[model samples]
Target: MASAEGIFEGRLRELCKQCPPWYKNPSLVRLYLLLIAPMMTTTAWGFDNALTNGLQSIDTFMNNFGNPQGSTLGFFGASMSVGGIIGCIVGGPLNDRFGRRPLISGGALLIVGMVIMQTFSSNFGMFTGGKLLLGFGAFIQQCAASVLVVELVHPKQREALSSFFNTNIYIGFIIGAWITFGTFRMTSQWSWKLPCILQLALPAYQVVMVWFCPESPRWLISKGRIEEGRQILIKYHGNGVEDEIVRVEMEEIMAGIEADKTMIKANWQGLKTVLGTKGNRHRLWICIVTAVGSQALGGSFVAAYLPQILDQVGLTSSKDKTLINGMMTIVNWLTAIIAAFVIPKVKRRTMFLFATAGMTASFIIWTALTAEYVKHGHKGLGIGVVVIIFIYNFFTSMCWVPLVIAYPLENVTTKQRAIFFAITLFSINVSAFCSSYLNPVGLAAIGWRYYLPQCCFNALMIVIIYFTFVETKGLTLEEIAIIYDGKESFEEAVHYVSMELNAKHSEAVSHVEEHTEVKA
Candidate 1:
């Protein structure tokens, strides 16, 4: 192995050679460091998900939780999604009215309390109630932190950086899996109980750290604190120069805020505004479909109920199922990390359509293969089902993991962003609630045909993607609204702003101009 100093020197050389000097600046470096705190909330989310899913397969949890039947298990699991729906609705208004920083700081502490409730619960009702709170807190953190990170960064870095926000969740998932796997033989209730109690640590740490992180500049601007938002933009992207890029970015942000204030019907009457206009309806349609497709079709199944599903499918060994569950999360994290990088290079519409296609095919194949294993009792077929399930997860993660959450944040204006997010969260809650209840019931009732509905959902999602979704790559936040507003064609807007794409020193403010409305 190379010596520490040699390795350090090589890494430094790589950075110096591959990266520009601005990335090494102290101000930018500090801003990046601060983002770590908001991200910790996602890590905790993964930990809980991993812990919950793995524990579901454990004998101790089954006994303590009263060995829930498939539908019963689904009902108990559905409790979390129900809570998430409420959180999204409630938290959206709070976040929009208050600010992103307070929401996260407070939500972190809230999760700690909820986890404590579950940790010491004495009955199924109490435990289910705690799970509801857990979903409430997690979605609150997840939804807000997502909008926060995307809003803080530069246009070029927006998609790529925002995708990393969930990277920690996968890490938490891995840790949660191992933690459950390690405690599998404890011969006591502590195995499941300990993990629930241990969750308190993540939120506790987030409370202390998130307090120090900078508030989102976009939120600050919307509240008429323009100077503060400008300063933050400078401090992070200014690279100490207050360069042209920063000026154009601020201009674009201003245009977006103004447009949103006037045009977004929901800026006035909350939910009613969501259904008011063609524009609002269009935005909501995208939000609802993506959220429903992601949770109901592919993502939630593996994350929440896979272990139980695995055990039911004749993979009867508790340890093996749990280990596979753990490995699946690791694979999930790895694929998401890969998607985070790969997605930026690909067009948003292209990626969405392809991911949907990939998922539809994977689901259909899984249903057939699992059906074969069920009918023939073939060991090789069972193994094939396992391989395909992991493939299913990768396809799910590659598509929904990065795009479903991050795209909507970028697609809408500031005024509706929170509401748009809430709408999506609402869809997720409904879809997840259905899936959470249906998965186990579906598995028991239909065997391998359980996957048939998932296949159909993605098939419908592909149609939505191809027709309704426009290409969002290479467009700044302000410019995106033009397309939504019928101001200019996406290609026209991209071309209009093409000159300022690499404006290092400071370009004219013309690129941020969306004054010319493109006629439909």
Candidate 2:
């Protein structure tokens, strides 16, 4: 019986020990654990979002909240997006200026306070306020957390850990679904309040944990704090060796910073560059579309409004809706975990095409099935629609779970990464806000025909993905810059370093052999 820690170390060692001296450190286990902590906090965002959707259908929740109707329900649903918009505006600047760790801690604290607000709210005003707070805090925390993890890890680790980071959404989704399902039968306010309290627990703990965490070395170096940044680099990447890998990665990062300055413009004018230069705009456009496409066109509208969407299609029971939502989230989680492994293996364009094609088919089918249920009064047709929705989630989850954030984080230069990400985050929330606000109202006015618009959205997304988005697969962050802006890319840079290291090693071995012969 191996202890969990022992098993983790065994796996970690098996995965990377042969790569390089630094990669062989058993303490690499700590980086994995450290990266995972912020992910749990992110789950709170997804969990509450799902919880609200489920609670919208819960009799007790509606009764307590005074039964918000179509447009109103939509507004409440969009509260998180509204908060995310604000969080993006403020948090991005704060994160860049202050550092990743502080923003993460601040976000954790904000979420804790917001959850408490929601739990104790005596009226709709209070609850809505709390919801806004939750959205703002979660968005800020997630932005900082995601960027931090992406900056902290090895390229191979990035593929799996990044996907795992987003997969935490499913954990929140499942918890939200089951909590609502379990509490839908409850005749008290505790039903809703209990979930709020549960949301508070994880991020509240993250605040304390993140405080002990180190700042991102890239960020420190970007700020010209070389000595401090080098210490962190040695700690994380060097494993105290201050060896070739550390020197090379640091040079790579510094080169990236220089390239970013040139490409983004001298004086590091990032935002203008992202919006101004023709080539950079291509990159920005892809980042925005990736963010927006993942949220808006990725079947998220279906996930967020599952219960309400089900009721519209005739699966009106909370038990069935909750049960199905729970199952759907569980499937989504497992599929996303699988997608994490698949990420490194598959190309980004392949995922976009697959997701677009599958989602388009799912929406079209769901629309048709819902129309049948509406016209024929056949309950089975509605059940069939739920199955399509599940399939839709699976496809979207594959790419949306990781690349929505990962592509932008990886594609943009270090200098421009924050602004690029902020803009992307802003775009995502805007797209989400529109979807959240419109879905229910559209459902009310047009019935299952609402999916007609979603079907059209997915159809359009397929073409956009096919034509506009370039393949980002297998490119290092530095290499990714050359894809859009530079001439000397990471692949070329790595090759140059590799030759230099081989020469250095050869010199050392030759020196040792000659000294041994002389002694003999």
Candidate 3:
């Protein structure tokens, strides 16, 4: 029996050897899976505070019509944005200086702490302070998680992998929305505060789990800890395949470092380097404009304010509101999951074009429905608004949400990546802060006319995506850099990387075959 078991083990090892390196690399797979939960939790927790509880708490204090005396409700809504701005400014340089693990762990702890504080807040000031801290923590986690995933994943799979992070964020948003609406029936404050407190579980788990996970090997290589990085790659890849994956990954890291040295400082100097040249400036503007276009399409406003909109549409029953919010969350997550699979097959430009057109059409339909409600006072208008909200989230999940996060990472080089992300986060928060205040007022004053502006924004987004946003599907980081710089065309960049990746695979196969022959 012992000999038979030994033979079975040997056969299993041989079978595994024939599999792809990615399949054999358990560490990478485990790391990817581990990140999903914490990311979802942190995102859910943060969104709960920003989009759900923050709004609910403010409404509670301000009597849902906003403060007559103009208390700190607006400030409370803006606190997260303020925290996010500060976090983006600080988190990137910290990630570059320290490793990804410390920031992730520390950020998680901070989120947990803030959520607890938020759950028990006595007054508006305490609630606002808690929100500010929560936003700061989320900012750290967002930047750290993003950079960490990119650093850890294979360059070939980077965009799709990065999209996973965005997907988790949507999932978190969905869960937070569902929980907030579900619990609201029990008690107003508890309904919202419970979700905020429940979010603490995610970061708590992340803090413990991340301790066991290894730091990004690419970061290690960048810091010139080659042997340490190699050991990690080996541990993750297993015993026999260590040297092969490490050598390739290390070469890429070294090349990136050499390229990065061209710009010594990644502060003002790095920003200038990316914008100093005419071509680089063009790329920068493309990134900036695309980001602005994405926000203006009203994705965040819809997600944060959907429940309130439902309330206004006469779906004010607690049970119905909870169910609808839950359904919306589920749809949003499902759409994002579909995007993860679809992104690999579709062109980014094509996806953006389709999504923009679909979203604009949906908004137009929604506007008409709202107008009909105002004129005729029919029940169907409520249903139409709900349908529009779902479609809005669906298109958002499918295109803008993923692209907005992935594109900037793809467009910028490593030296400029931190600064670029900082700028992007700033734009997002600034837009969010403005929208948070304006959305409620717009709803009260102009009714659904607010969506008309978004319709125009979406149309502009389609035009910009068609003309400016280049297709980046299936390109290596270096190839993407070249394409962004106009040194290569889209087709050429894709072809070059495909050939290089194919060559690398062939070489690995040959090495394995040679080893087998030697052993035989």
| TM-scores of all candidate predictions against the true structure | 0.87, 0.88, 0.82
Question: Per-residue alpha-carbon lDDT of model 3 for 374-400, expressed as tens digits?
Answer: 778777888888888888778888987
- For TM-score, candidate 1 versus 2, the one ahead is 2
Q: Which scores higher on lDDT, 1 or 3?
A: 1
Q: Model 2, 460-516: lDDT tens per residue?
A: 888988888777665566656766764644445545655655687699899999999
Q: Give the Å shift of residue 134 in candidate 3.
A: 0.3
For model 2, the superposed segments whose C-alpha errors exceed 4 Å read 1-24, 262-271, 488-520
| Cα error of candidate 3 at position 97, Å | 1.5
At residue 145, candidate 1 shows an lDDT of 78
lDDT of 3 at 66: 39
Best by TM-score: 2
Q: Mind giving the per-residue lDDT tens digits that candidate 1 earns over 1-520?
A: 1112221123322332343444666766677678777867678767877876887877888888788786667778788788888888888778788778777877788888988888788877798888888888888877777888788765556777776676777888888898888888888988788877888887888778877777888889888898798888887777666666676566656655654533333355645655665766777777887788778676677878777567555687879888898888888889999999888778988888877787788778777877777788887777777888888888777868777777777778887787678778788889989877887787777766667767787788888789988676755566556655654333343343433343622343443343333321
* Ranking 2 against 3 by lDDT, winner: 2
In candidate 3, position 85 carries an lDDT of 76
Clashing pairs in 3: none
Evaluated with lDDT, which candidate comes out highest? 2
Instruction: Report clashes for each candidate as comma-separated counts.
Output: 2, 0, 0
What value of lDDT does candidate 1 attain over all alpha carbons?
Answer: 0.74
